[model samples]
Target: MDEPARRGRLPLPHRGIAFGGDYNPEQWPRETWAQDARLMREAGVDLVAVNVFGWAEIERSPGVYSFEELDSVMDLLHEHGIAVNLGTGTSTPPPWLTTAHPEVLPVTREGETVSPGGRQAWCPSSPVVREHALRLVRATAERYGDHPALALWHVSNELGCHNALCYCDESASAFRRWLERRYGTADALNAAWGTSFWSQRYGSFDEVLPPRLTASAENPTQLLDFRRFSSDELLEWYRAEAQVLRASTTTPVTTNFMVTAHIDTQDYWSWAPDMDVVANDHYLDHRLDDPWAELAFAADATRGLAGGAPWMLMEASHGAVNWQPRNLAKAPGELERMVLTHVARGADAVCFFQWRASRAGAERFHSALLPHAGTDSEQWRATLRLGALLDALDEVVGTRPTSDVAVVFDWQAWWAVDAGGHPTQDVRYLDEVHAMHAALRRAGVGVDVVSPDTDLSGYRLVVVPTLYLVSDEAARSVERFVVGGGHLLVTYFSGIVDENDHVRLGGYPGAFREVLGARSDEFFPLDDGESVALDDGGVGRVWTERLEPRGATVRARFTDGPVAGGAAVTRHEHGRGAAWYVATRLGTGGRDALVTDVLEGAGVRPVLPGAGGDVDVVRRDGDAGSYLFVVNHGDDAFVARAPGVDLVTGRRADAHEVPAGGVAVVREQPTGRRRPSEEAPA
Candidate 1:
């Protein structure tokens, strides 16, 4: 038994929240440069990510480079005491490169080459594109590697955002090679992909190509492997540039990850290892009608990727992003809530998408710290106030949240559960996971959304929802946890497949049947808007399974359905712990009831006893002691007694009332110099 290696560290001089974000001086006039610095300084901005999309301005043509304009921007920001998160500017290749080398452009699934008007239009596996991107990175590193204000080496902008699924000939070749390495031979690949289902079997690796424009739906396993390959391909590109930066400087290297549930091109669990600090750009998906909950979940997921270490909020919208269908601006005080939520989770730094507003291009309407209305605008003032508030809460940095409960929300499960051939197409792994997590949050319980590969010994209760893909090793680990007195709750569609998307034999939920003391006979998927009544006065929708209790105690039964009176939920008492199986999609009310029972059985409690459902509470353990962050996302006022002094205001009161869309961070009174726990975040 040995401790895991320490995760990556931040590149700043000390543990302090970096406060600025993507700065594009190339888009503005030189006259506004000094004004940018003045405004940043006034806002207490300490970092700026520059050169993110400046490929054209950096290198006008092949074999040619210019640093005069960038030098001015960098020097000006440095003079004002603002550090730089220098990007390689390879996200968007200049039009000259795309025009000269059209082969480097990405091709759609239908084989049409994508034009270079938008960003991330280059093929990730294109040798020509990789060579040029590496060259630019090396040149940038050699020039600014030792700059006085170099805080972080931003390898490239968000990887795999637009060009994740390139179907060009080059990608096809690369995908074939990746398959060959993964499976060793085409026969093994055919077996894994189950190509025999369509009477199509590959005799050689070359026969396999990127799944595109097939006569029918592509092979589920083939599509999954391609997703992995695409993510790894982009990761390799980032690693290449990161190597160049590490060779030239000591600055930590990272590329922002789109870890939101909406974007799934990159598997951040695999990509996180290459980054020195797991930085992520999270934008609220307003379509969900619960952007606050999504933001919290994204932060939790990103922190899990970072191994519970302090990560960075690289790019969040100042108000609304221009990309979404309907861009709604953030209400007053909403910015503070969004930023503090990340800080309350595990973010050491909070930054936005841009420092100033854009006047042209696709993002001109996107909000910024300095809006088009200038310094007198509400956005500017709100940003300024946020920066000052962050400066006062330096003690919150480098802390990790300790949770009594963990939700096993595997990304692989997310990918596999939604693939074709599922019993119910309407079932979404993320949606179910969010429902479970939201239940815990509403109950005022702290939760850590972790990967299945994570150790389960630290948690009292481990919740799994729609874990459609489970490896044998992970299954054994869960079994060991329950045997060692850890409560386990697994939902439907779990333990059905191995890592290769192959079904496990014996019964449904193959790997976990014994642990749960139950077996599912068959799946009964409900039609749209259909639901079954539960014995507990709750409704189960989307899916249900006929469960035959082996050695488990039936917890709940279906009141009316094809399998009426059958077990809908069961709890099995193992050697020293307990295991629960939920065999249906229990919509909100049902889910909340099940979660409440499990939490009560496990004795898990919330940070604040009387905290409202809309008031999110999280505790972070740092060198300074435990800090409680109480954030109210509701409209009404909420009150929570302070455990220590409020970090934002130097006030110490028995009760602290926060207004709607407000936040409060209180440091717990020290108990004679207690040491912070070094346990990894669950």
Candidate 2:
């Protein structure tokens, strides 16, 4: 809230959710702007994002600026009573600039320097690139500084573009400088990147190699360093615009991260701190249940980034996207429910990719508020319904839920696993992480998706999934939590590796093995359809391992199978507390059962009672306040048997069974007690 307020508004604005999508008047004729605005009003769209990729139009030639078109667009939107989120137009380098300043282009993993056309194609480390990029930003802000319609400043389209960059002399030199700023000298850099392994010793700062094809990522440390470097590279870019944008204009600045993204390769835990609010282009893969889980976790993670402040869904589909092999339409109440579900979690706004459908391009068939032939289509009706809901909710967008349980979502570990050469590639990090998180939500546990670096003392229970890399400091943090008599859950692959993607050098599940009360000597990576029987734990596929106990008790062992006596799950007593380890990849049911058992033991249950299925009910109950957000994920029409009156209508959610894809928002009355924070400020 401090950061958001500093940027000039409540996280989502106390008024309610923003209802608008990306609008590009530059793509069409001037005549079309009026029709688009009229249609936007009819669709209940209130906020419009513009100038996202108008580099060519904004800058017709070098040193010659043309923002007249943009000025008119912003003014008209303001006249229409729509809030504007003006972008910096730096995502793509203008064709003229790219043709002249070829060095501004980025180097690919294959060591090929690109020639522009694509977005985020500029080398982040290139001074020339930064100069021109920041110039555009300062120019836009200076011109539109006092505009009332100007609400937020979208820095660049997607900071996530293909490949790690700056393999050129400029980047190499910049990389050296970056290293100097991070680690003091060549020796520190050597240790951090483990350069001694390949005899790749750097005699001087100039001798170091960029993490490109030329460097050859044969060493795991090299690859990981490149990952770190690339993330930092993106961070540098985000910080640049944020710094300049905040100088004169006090608009909230945000860049979109693609949630569960594999290609862009950024660690949000590291990047999120710089933002006023975290925004992501959250496009779901065709799989619906997985989408629901991902949305919940991602939204929670964004909110939890800064003391559970609401985040923005910078991009959503009005209907479907062209990229998915099978793009499916949103079901009856699905879109509206999905919108409300994000609100329930902690979302300030939800914006679609484009305001109107494209007549051409890769995204021509992509979903939009206005179909290819603009009208009040099913999607438009869906958008309207959500807007109507927000109208009814009356600005629940920026409200922060004071009560929450921290569920550690370690992206560092997630990245380490993805980079590490696992016994099998079939093991799904995204799926597994989501499954456990979904279970916690289903049990009505108000979750705070956090990282190992997050402060953990506030939470009664902390759950870590597939924690492959456990830094000594992070381990001690967990130890402190357990020592303070807090509950802990560490699952398989929990502590098998270090930062270098190297195993702990002892038995499998090495360091966490003791914390988990067992050690695995062998790991089995099964085919997708294959299954290994779990005694009380449940059978699983993808990855399974056998454990040897040092201390702690075996909770579940494989039953009636080849590894009948092997450990599947274990519990250990460490420093006046308990730690649970789930050692296998269970299907949804089995995973839920394991997680639910742990939650029940801790006596920290979901707000909703008894066997809930796909519906994820999370309650934020505390002295400050209590909020119950219920989400239904199953395809079939499902009713959430939640206990509480709907805060919006004051009607009991139990009176009428909610429709499938439906959600209920219940604000519970807090008892006569004050929060710890109320007693003492953090």
* Top TM-score hit: 1
TM-score of 2: 0.91
| Best prediction by lDDT | 1
TM-score of each: 0.97, 0.91
Compose the digit string of candidate 2's lDDT tens values, residues 211-326: 66643446666666666777888788889998988898777788887765344378777887788777777766665556766777777776766557657778888677887778
The local distance difference test score of model 1 is 0.86
Model 1 per-residue lDDT tens digits across residues 1-682: 0113225335576457879888999999999999999999999889999999888998998979999999998899889999999999999999988898999989998889998898988999999989998999999999999888888888778888899899999999999999888999888888898889978799899788898888887788988999889989998998889888888887778889997878878877887777778889998888895788888888988888888888899999989899888999988878888888899988988889899889999889999989999988888888889988999888777678878788887777787888778777888888878877888888887788888889989888899888889989999999999999889999888999998899898888789999999998798988999889999888898888889999999989998887899999999998788999998888777788788898878767667778748999888886658888989988899888755788877788777888888888888787553221122122
Say what the RMSD of model 2 is: 3.7
- What lDDT does model 2 reach? 0.72
**Model-by-model lDDT, in order?**
0.86, 0.72
Counted clashes in each candidate structure: 0, 10
Name model 2 segments beyond 4 Å from true: 1-14, 163-169, 214-217, 261-264, 287-289, 402-404, 500-508, 521-530, 559-564, 619-627, 635-654, 667-682
